[model samples]
Structure formats: structure tokens, C-alpha cells
Target: MASNRPAPEAPYEPSRHPETFGYGDFRADEGPWEEWNPTEDSLQQVRGRHRVAKQRGGGLARSSTVLGVGVIAAVGAGGMASANTGKPPVSIAMPDLPSVDSLLGNGSQETPAGSGTALSALGVSSDDSAQGADDAGEALRNRIMAQAERQQGQAENKATAAADQRILAAAAQAEKVAATQAADAKEKAAAEVKKQAEAERLAKLAKQYTLPTSSYTITSTFGQAGAMWSSGYHTGLDFAAPTGTLIKAIHSGTITEAGWAGSYGYRTILTLNDGTELWFCHQSSISVKTGQKVATGEIIGRVGATGNVTGPHLHLEVHPGGQATGIDPMTWLRGKGLNP
Candidate 1:
């Protein structure tokens, strides 16, 4: 049923329920509206118009500030990640809303669904995301540094190896130079030794030998062809000198003959230790007797033209091994290092 007489003077009390309500059901018939003072519990049910508006505006302001801060943090992290990896920015997914109790620290029985503002309702924390980005950046920096150090080590090793190779090459070159010098020095030493040995041999030969005559001019050589010789060939060397010029014994020997024979007016024969014979002919006088031993360079005779000769000269002949045929005395003397 409906009634238009008057509405209730008090608001409905849900505690006293009759499964239905009608007009005039909560009326106090004797009370005026001005006389009534509403209980605190009743006043909380309906907000004033200004209070509601103020609460709604405050919620909007808080939501705007929190959302702005969250957005900035997220963007900053993405930028840092992109710079480090040289990649696109990473997107952060929106989190589920926070509980009203968590946001307000108040004794609200509201769940996250009933939280006042959208940003406050979010479950993710900006600090946690920013800290993760810092960790990632640190890891990336460490990796890059490790790679750089590894490359530097490899380069250093290669440079060291190249230097070692260069040192080895230089050492080998030095060794080759030293070896060449040693070879040249050895050859020079050998040549010097040979020259010294020859000098010693010549010195020994000089001690035991002498020339047949001194201060005399060679008038004729052996093997000369002329009519002055009976055989049409001179067989001995001729030394021209003043009469009675002293002639020498040449070397130590025994006199085998000391007398004139045929064309030889005064002649002497010296038989050497080795059976070679030295013949001195055309002498003015002979000082040696047959079978007499004479020392080297002993005055054996005087120069004179006693044989078939034209002037005062001594004819000298050498018979190798006492053979009648003779070799050139000049050629034989040269073999003993005598220039004349």
C-alpha cells in the first residue's frame, strides 16, 4: 500500500526488518524534525556535499602525483637499459592494484579493487625496478671490461713474440758474422805459418853454403857456343878477374884432384859429401892437395887464364853425382835462394 500523508521522521533502521517497509513505518508521531539530534553512526551514512567534493578532489591529486612519479622512474630505467645495450627501450607491464589498507595505513576492510586511485592501486614498486636496472648496468660494464682486458693481453703476447723473433734473427746474424771472421783469421794464420817455415829453411841453407868467388864479374856463361872452345860449346861458367884473384872452395869438400891436365894449366877438383864434383880450371895457383879436406869458403886457388881462354878468368863447372855432363851452375845456385 502507498500513503502520501507523511514520510518517516527517522531514517530506516535496517536492524528491525519486517521483510518490507511502507510510508510512515519509521515515524515518531509526536516528535518534530528540529528537536531530533542524529546519532554518530547515522551521520556517517550520508556525507555533506562539500565534504564529498573535497575527498574526490584530494584522491585525484594524489593519484596524479603518484602516477607521474611512477612513469618517470619507469622511463628513466628504460632509457638507461637502452643506452647500455644499444637496443630498444623495454616496456614495463602495469601491475595489479595495491590494497587500500597498504595505501592508507588505515583500518580499511577494502581490497585492492576498492583502492581510491589507480596509481596507488598498483602493486609494483618503482624502487625495485630501478635497482634491477642498476644491477644490469653493472653487469654489462663488467663484461665489457673483461673483454677489453682479454684482447689487450692477446695483443701483448703477439708483440712479445715478434720481439723475440727479432732478437733471435739478430743473434743468428751476429753468429754468422763471427763465423766468417773466424774462418778468415784461420786462413791468414795458416798462410803466415807457411811463410815462416820457408824463411827458416832458407836461413838454415845459408849457414852451410858459400859462393865460389867474391867481387868477380861473370865473363861467360855455361853452354855458350863459340870457336874459343874446342868442343864448339863452353861447358862451364867463366868469372873474369885480375890475375891472382882469390877463388873460394864454395862448400866443405875433399879435394879429389889438384894438378894440371892437358889444356888445363892449373886445375882443382872438389868432391862434396854427396858425391857432386866442383871443377875449378884455368887457375894461376892451386892451394889444395889431393885427398885434402877443405872448409867452406876456403881460398882454394887464384884466378888466371891457364886453360884455352883469352883473359884472366876462372872456369867453374859442376858435375851432379860426379857425372861428366853438367847442369848450369847459375840455375843450381838459384834453387838455394842465391840470385847470382
Candidate 2:
């Protein structure tokens, strides 16, 4: 059996020592010699020394030294075999070894539960990791929903404001239209009231007066320009009719004059209570004496073509306050509520 003991060290030569030392010349054959070869018993004795050193706190250093020696011996043997057979050198593979801490049990206590280990340092379990992911997704979804709700609320507020604005605008327009309609209605009411008052006044006047002649056609209006009159313009109104046409009092009055005049033939003058005078000329015959009282529409004379007159007609003149000049008879008659 092969012995596992290491070779013995050679003796140091005096000549090789750097220190000045001398020894008597010696021969290798002259020294007392003993034939020494390795044996299993000798190897067992060296291994026992290694175990003893380990107990003295030198185990780690000794183990490194032993491993290095083994590697060198293995390489030397492989080299020698290759040189002798002239074959290609073989490749050697090394096995992984445990760290010093592991081999010595320096930090080899079982990891406490829930403490950081290889797996814990990397991450949590699949279930825990999935739960964390779900929580994050739910949080994001809640944030998105909250934001959407806020935006929706803002949109609704804006829409409500717009609707209110439109309502306000419509209300303002309605108010304006109502005001205009009220004003128009008020104006119409005022105009209607004024028209009704005028009609009532005219109706009262019609009962107080009457026309002077019956069945007579108007031949001349007051203010008519003519060559036949003494004045440049006609001062009276003329009524043309047959000789038998009757002339009557225009209102309740007393006869002031009767009989012939220079241009007004068979003239008659009536004076009203207000000192207004009505003159009827060109009469065929007189129906009342002077100073006689006559009622409205009572016959005073008959139509004739008498002095200074053209065919049968009545010339009527009105004098207010008995002035020398007369006003238009047609206007006075209209004021008394007679259209003719």
C-alpha cells in the first residue's frame, strides 16, 4: 500500500547560509545513515499531530495548508505520468467547497422564522405579492373614479349655471314684452275715451238747435268771392229753393227786424238771448211781425226772388254780438249741431 506521508526536509548547507557560520568539511557517505521510507504507521502518526493542532485553535490554518499540499502533489503526479507516456495532459476539475464560516459552524444557526433569508431577501411569497398588486390596482381605480366624479360635478354645475342664465334672459325678455303691451293698451284706452266724449257732446248740441230752411239746396257758402256782392267776398250763406219753400228760426229767438232792405229783399232779423243775430233775406212773404217771439224750427218767411236777387233763394247771415260784420253762417250752423 502506498504511504500518504510527506517527504522529509533536506539538511541546510553551511555554504548556503547567509550568516557567517562554519562547519568542518562533511561527506554524505561519512555521516551515520539510516534507510528511511514512508509507511502507513508513520502517516498515522502525522495525522494524529494534525488532529492535536486542530484542538489548539489552529485547525483552519492547518486545513488550508493540507489542501494546498494535496493540490501540488496531484499536479506533480499528473505531469510525471504525461512526460513518461508522452500522452496529452488531462484536464482537472475542482469541486466547490463550503465557505469557512459554514464548515466551522460560525454562523450556521437556523434562520429564525420571519427573518430575512435567501427567499425573503428576494421577495414575499406569490400570494403576498399578488395581494400587494391588487391593493395598488384598487387604489389607482379609486383615484380615477374620484377624479371622474369631480369632473362630472363640475360639468353639472356649469350646465346648471347656463340654464339659469337662459332662464334669467327669458324672464327679462318677458318683462319687456309685458311692459310694451301694457303701454299700448293704455294708449288705446285713452284714445277711445276721447272719441266717446266727443260723440256725447255732439249729441247734446243737436237737441238745442235746428236748420233755418226746409227743402233748400245750398247755392253759396260764406267767404265765397263774387262780383255780385257789395263786399269782395260773400258774407252770408245762400239756400236756393222754389218760391214756396219755408224759412224757419234757427234757434229760440225774437224777431228784431222785418220788411224790405236795399239788397236783402223782404228781410227779417232775429236776435237770440245771447245777443247773436240771424238775418234772413230774399223772402217772398213774412210770417211774423217785428218783436214777435218764435221758437226753434218755427216758420218765419217764404223763399222768393225779390229785390237784388237771382232766382228763388234765401240769404242767411250770422252776426255775433250784433257787430256790423257777420261771420260764416255755415260755421255757426255746424256749431249748433246742424251739418247743413
Candidate 3:
């Protein structure tokens, strides 16, 4: 029958060997084994030899044990795969190795050489590791605090800028409002000054002149059109009153003419210092002579319906610069601060 065993792998060769274990006479195929029962004396000699060999072989026993454990782990994994696949478990041949008691001694524990020195070299003390962790934590905390402070400062700067902008806007608005108020006040003040000046001018005119007559009604105004006059339109104002009503000088002036004329009947012409002529016509009598100087309000004539008569009244005309054309007497009187 054919054998079911797998082919043997190549023999392992140890790179180092003990000086006492020599392989000078070893033969694999020609070996004829002889069996003998063990005695206490023989076993003691074998144990003593193994101890001596283990001391001389350095870490050979430890290396063998490590290799054996690795093989057993691989075999276990293979056996599980075979069981799942419903196949026969693979057979792994194990080499002869020294017993654990022989490798270490009766009950002694084996420690790898220089293991304490290696652990000391590789490991850090608890104090140093804890201090490093604390330092890292402190550095992280400091970085976080610094970032927060920077953010706060930026926020403050932004707020300050916004506040400043608002302040500037308010100031600008206030300045504009103030300017408008000032302009309004200045304009009002100027208008008040103009009004006062006008008042003073009217008062002065009132003191300088007087009306021609009092207690009379205005019968005809200048520019009245009818067939009662030589001209197409009335050229003078008419004041109707009872006969013998006194007429007075309108202003300080010289009586240039005080006599009868054709259509005027009884007439008097007064010339002012400024060459303005005042004609008092249709008078019942003249009280001032020609070229006589009369003061304002002095009696100059009496009212009468003479010359193209219709009723008893005084006809008054005014001509500036002695021009042939006369202006409205009512307007001229009012210009001198006299209402009539």
C-alpha cells in the first residue's frame, strides 16, 4: 500500500551550534535503533547534560519554543479549515524539542537576556508622560484663549467703527439743521429792517406836507370823462363844498398866479421849491397874491363854481416840473403822505 504521508521538507540548519553537540558520525538512512528501559541514574545524567547544554547553547531552547508555538498556531488554523470543508485534517510533524522544565530548570522561570534594559530603554516614566500630556493640554488651552481674545478685539473694533459712523451721521444732520435755522433767522431779520425803514419814510413825508382842504367831499376825480371840460377828459380833482369854503396851500410854495383866467374864472397857481406846480382853480376868491410866498396850510382861496360851472367846488391839478400835462392830484396828495 502507498503511504499517505506528505513529502518531508528540507532539514533546518541552525546558524549557531553548541561546542559539545557535534554531528561528525550522524547517518539518516543507516540507523538501527536499540530500545532500553530508563533508570533513575540515567535520567539524572540526561537532565544534568541538558542543563549543561542549555547553558552553553545561549538562547537555542527559547528560539525552538517560539518556533514550536508558531507551528501549533498554523496547524490549529489549518485544522479548522479542514473541518469546515469536510476533509481530513493535515498532519504536521513536530521536531524533538527539550521539555519546558529542562529548558528553564525544575520550577524556575526563564527571562530573555537584557529584557529589563530593553524595557527601560523603550518606556517612559509615568511622571514624565503625565507632564507632557499636561503641557500639551496647556498649550492647546493657551491657543484657544488667544484666539478668543483676538476675536473679541475684532468685535470691539467693529462696534467702535459703527458707533463712530453713527456719531458722524448725527453730527452732519445737526449741522444741516442748524444751517437752515440760521438762514431763516437771517432772512427774517432783513425783512424786519426793511419794514422799519419804510415806516420812517412815511412818517417824514406826513410831517412835510398837508391836505389842500378839509370837510369836503371828492366830487370828480382826475381823468373823469364828460362834456363839462375843455379837454377830452377831466385833468384835475374836484372837491365839492359850500361857497366861501377856505382853501389852503398844500405845501410851502410861492403863489405864481392868483387871478381870473378864461375857463378857470378864479384861479391860483402855486409853485413849490422843486418846480412842481399846484393849480387851485374855480375858486370863489383868491386870498394870496401872485409871487407871494405862502407856508403849508395857509389860506390860499375859497371854493366856488366859476368858469364852466356846474356846482360849488374846488378843482385842483398838479404838474411836476411845470409840465403842460398834469398828473392825478389824488395820487400826488397820497405820495406826500396825505390820504385825500
Candidate 4:
């Protein structure tokens, strides 16, 4: 078999074939397949994509920065306006962000800071605030002082009124005491004057009166129970005395009778100016005549036992005008300050 097939060409070398290497159907008019290169339009499209990506990223960063600065400016402007206008502060809710000053670190110090306005927009001036506070304090102090003064004045008035009341009460009590003392003194003075007048009257009456007889003992009173008298009772005061004892007239009077009359052995009757009659009965003898004017203490009779008497005694009797009934001589004599 080695004769004609020439050793089979060493098993055909396909690796050396044009198709195997991809150049068997190569064409000049068509583009080369092995070497593929991009056109200018395609290259431009890729470059555009890269540029758009980079620009969009930069825009996002710049937009975020602008938003932060705007929010800060709005907040600052609102606060400043509210403070300057004396309005209530406005509250704003915002996301945390860097400060506007920090973000604008490269800016100048004199640059308009908050919302591009001046610092005067913050609030009231310092001097004005201080003056307002001082004024309020002074007004309060004045009110307190005025109230205290009014209270003190009221208290003083009350004390003065109380003192006046006490004075009036004391004065009233003193007047009452003075009136009572004056009344007592007047009563005592009246009593003393009346006593002096009575004493003078008694002294004058003593000179005009006298006792009927001297040195005689009284044996019986005017009214006595006995069977020894004609009238069945003792009718006169009996003066027991020795015979010849002098019996005198009691006062100045006229002698109405002087004689022996029955049981009345020696009797005398004297009539006074007041129509009172004095009888001297049971006498030993008579010294005065009828119708004789006699002086006080003149001898009218002498004492003796007579007039149905058991012993020698002078019987004296007193009778009112026109009445034979005799009263007690002792009682009559005492009316003129005579004890007997």
C-alpha cells in the first residue's frame, strides 16, 4: 500500500488549512474578521455615558448642599424676625445638618450671616430690658409701702377710740360719786340746824314754869283704886309732906277760889290763861283769896290731911275748862319740861 498513496501526506495537516486559521473565506471589501476595530460614533457614545454619570453625581452633591443652606437661612431668618418684632418665637423641625457658618468657612467675618440681615434683628436692646425690669420693681415697692401705711393708720385710730371710751367711763363714775357725797352732806347739815332750833325753844319755856310744891313725897297717882275717897277712886295726885309744907302756884294765873269746901278742908283753885284750872285740895290752910291775880311760884296754900285722906298729904288736880274730870298732873307738868 505504500506505493501510490504517498504515505498519506502525513495525515493531512488541518492546523495548516486556511479555513482552520480563518483565512480561507477572507474578503477585502468586507471588513476583516480577525481584526475588529470600533468606529468613531461608537467611541463617542461610550464617552458620553461616562460624562453624564460624572455630571449627575456632581449635581446631586451640589443640590444637597444648597438644600442644607436654604433650610439654615430660613430658620435663622424666622428666629431673627420674631425676636426683633417682639413676637413669639417660631419653632421649626429640621434634619440635623452642618452649621451655615461651618459650611461657609471660607467666607469673610463681616459677611451678612443669617438670611443676609444685620444683628439688630435678634431681640430688644439690653438697656431697654434693664430699665423695664427696674420700673416694675419700683412700682411693686411703692404699692407695698402704701398698704403698710394705711394699716398702721387704722390701728392707731382704733387705739385712740378705745382711750376715749375709757376716759368717758371714768368721768361718769367720778360724777356719780360726787353727787352721792353732796346729798349726804346736805342731809347731815339739815339735821344739825333742826336740832339747834329745838334746843333754843326748850330753853325759853323753862323760865315760865314752876313746880307746885317743894320737898314733897308722891304717895299716889291721879287715878288709883281705893275705897277711901267719895268718888270711889283717887281723883288727884297726892303729895305726902309734913304739916305746914309750903305749896306754890305752878304758873302766873288768877285765883278763882280759896276756902274750906267739905272734905277738902283748906282748898284753892287757880285758873290759867289757857282756860286750864289747877285745884289745891286737902290743904291745911289757904294763902290766896278768890279773884286774886297771882304770880308764878307764889304761896297759894299749905299741905295738910284732908279730902277723905288717911294721912296728911296735898291732893293736886288739873281740869280743863268747864270739865270736872281731872287729868294726871305729873303728865301735864312733864309737857312743860317739868319731871315732877
Clashes of each: 2, 0, 0, 0
- What lDDT does model 2 reach? 0.72
lDDT of 4 by residue, 1-340 (tens): 1222222222212122232112454322321112112234423655333432222225335655775576668757765554444444445433232244433333332322223232232344555444555655677789999999999999999999999999999999999998998898898888888877765765566567788888888989977988877788888888888888999988899999998888877789999999899989888889879999998889988989866668888888899783889888888877666777
TM-score, structure 4 vs. true: 0.47
Any idea what lDDT model 3 has? 0.72
lDDT by residue for model 2 (254-285), tens: 99999999788899999999999999999999
The Cα error of candidate 2 at residue 83, in Å, is 67
Candidate number of the best TM-score: 2
Candidate 1 lDDT at 138 equals: 84
The list of candidate 1 runs beyond 4 A from truth reads 1-205, 218-240, 258-267, 281-285, 305-319, 323-340
Can you list the residue pairs that collide in candidate 2?
A: none
* Model 1 agreement with the true structure over 1-340: per-residue lDDT tens digits: 3323433466322222222111224423211212122334433655555222223225434654675687677666665554455443444544333343433333432223221222321333456545556777788899999999999999999999999999999999999999999999999999999888877876676666777777789978989999978888888888888999998887899999999966767999999999989999999999889999999889999998886778888888989999989889887765555555
Cα RMSDs, all models: 14.5, 19.7, 15.6, 25.0
Residue 314, model 3: lDDT of 90
Candidates' C-alpha lDDT? 0.70, 0.72, 0.72, 0.68
**Runs of candidate 3 exceeding 4 Å displacement:** 1-184, 219-234, 262-265, 308-310
Cα distance off (Å), candidate 4, residue 297? 1.1
lDDT of 4: 0.68
